[model samples]
Target: MLDPLRLAVGTLTALPVSPPGRIDRRVAGRAMLLAPIAVVPLAVVAGVVLWAGHALGLPSLAVAGVAVGAVALGSRGLHLDGLADTADGLGASYDRERALDIMRRGDSGPTGVATLVLVLIVQCGAMAVAGPATGAAAVLAGRCVLSLCCARGVPSARPEGLGATVAGSVRIPLAVLVFLLAAGLSCLLPGLPWWRGPVAVAVAYAAAGLLLWRCTRRLGGITGDVLGACVETATAAALLALA
Candidate 1:
């Protein structure tokens, strides 16, 4: 249990944590399932920043932007990098090998840059309208989608890196359970109508699933970058739905 927790935190955020003593599919599965829980520190930090921004009478959009930036910093911008790489992969030549090569590159291209800018804008705008509680919920929902990405039938696009370590490691039942629990809890988000929470979660998953399907078709399967793209996409969608 502790190893799973450590793996989740160590991978998902910049927060310091000891690496798990051993890592196999079982550990990776549990880590993906625990992603939301492990990211609680990051979420809490975002919540505090959002609260403080409002308390100081800052412009809601500006505050939301700061909060979003804070989360990116907390995660060491790994997800954002993933998002950019995924975008570049998708927009690159349709040849699977070529696209994968582009995604594996260290630099971002024009398409990746544009996609990142648009997604961040949407995230910040929606967060401004959704308020602090929903903002935090959106962030958690973002990570919760990772479990779904690792469900048993999913395959890794490549045989190495973080993707292969966790891809297809999660049991379908466990992944579905994590997703359902996240959706159910969304109904409890403060200041939101009961319907909005679940709807927001649903919207988030739908957006992520679309991306998952596209990536699977275009790139042969999921990669670490695809997982990151799903997180950011779901976060933006959830915030939009809540707003």
Candidate 2:
């Protein structure tokens, strides 16, 4: 059996996968099953930092902002990259293929930059108001929803890239299992009302689903960057709604 941690790390990070192990259908499906496992530590660390900041007399807003930035760094700015690429692709008046070409380019355009700023601003503002537990939950929920997007929409798009490679390989049941696990983890937050966490997760998933549908309609599927974008956008939306 493949180590779940290895698959999770390989999938979540841009770190080099030694030997570039073959990701078959079962492996891809299993990878989705493991994605949420990665989120558990991330959520825990963010929550601890937020709580520690409050306990240490640090301004909640400052702490929240730093916490957000820290989490972003841990993910290696993967979602930010996605958010920018998706914005560029969506804003481009060129054909979908050309827009995708623009997105694939390593440069960020005005629209992309603006979208990134807007997302961070909203996320920070929400975190400041909602306090740490809710904010952390929102972030975790958003990550889970993004994983769902990879398991569902991206795979079906059959695009000629990462989306295609991973999507068709995973099974739906395993994907759902991962989402449930992530949701369960979100509920573990102390002082966070039980119902609220699940409700927040549902909202995040709904928003992500709609956004993914729109992106698929426009571009016929999602890219790795688009997946990252979905996570950030959904997380922001969830935080705003919770706030």
Candidate 3:
């Protein structure tokens, strides 16, 4: 359990954690279950930064940029890489084989570059006018997509790699429980009205679900890139909804 938690935080965030040399599928799957644990600190930091920025009399737009910058720095832009790759893969080809090949090519295509820029713009813009709580809730809502992406029965696009091992990490019951808890917690974030918290979470879930379905049809299954895209998409959508 500790190993999964460590691996989850270590892999997802810039925070220091000594991960095990060998991570089995069970461990990887559990890592997904604990993914939200990794997100809490990032959300808190962003929220605090937003609050501090407001108190310091910084412009709301500047505060929004700083909040986005904080999470991007902390996450090492890991998920953004995925978003770019997935976009490149999907946009470059209609054939599954070719799309998957393009994704692994490690070069950003026009689509990937364009999407990355656009999504970042949307996220930053939304966070700009959002309250501290809304900023925090948006972060949590985005992270909540992790549970859905790693839920049981989701298949990997490839036979091996990060996606295969982490696919179906948590069973439906546990995933559902996590989603509910995360959803409930999201409401506590300040910018949005009481009802918007669940709405924000739903936006993330809808984004994740939409990505999963599209990837399954286009790429044959989910890849690490796809998962990355899921988080990025959810983050954008949740922030917009919350904003």
- Using lDDT as the measure, the top candidate is 1
Checking candidate 1 for backbone clashes, the offending pairs are none
Which of the two, 1 or 2, has more lDDT?
1
Q: Against the unseen true structure, what C-alpha lDDT does each candidate score?
A: 0.91, 0.72, 0.85
RMSD of each: 0.8, 2.7, 1.4
Instruction: Give the lowest summed-lDDT range of ten residues in model 1.
Output: 126-135
Local accuracy of candidate 1 as per-residue lDDT tens digits, 1-243: 999999999999999999999999999999999999998888887888889999899899999989999999999999999999999989988999999999998599999999999999999988887677888999999999999899888889999988899989999898889878988888888887888988988898999999999999998889999999999999999989988
Top-down TM-score ranking: 1, 3, 2
Off by over 4 Å in 1: none
Q: Whose lDDT is higher: candidate 1's or candidate 3's?
A: 1
Candidate 2 Cα lDDT to native: 0.72
Candidate 2 lDDT trough over 10 residues, lowest sum: 13-22
**What's the residue-level lDDT of 61 in candidate 1?**
92
40, model 1: CA deviation in Å?
Answer: 0.8
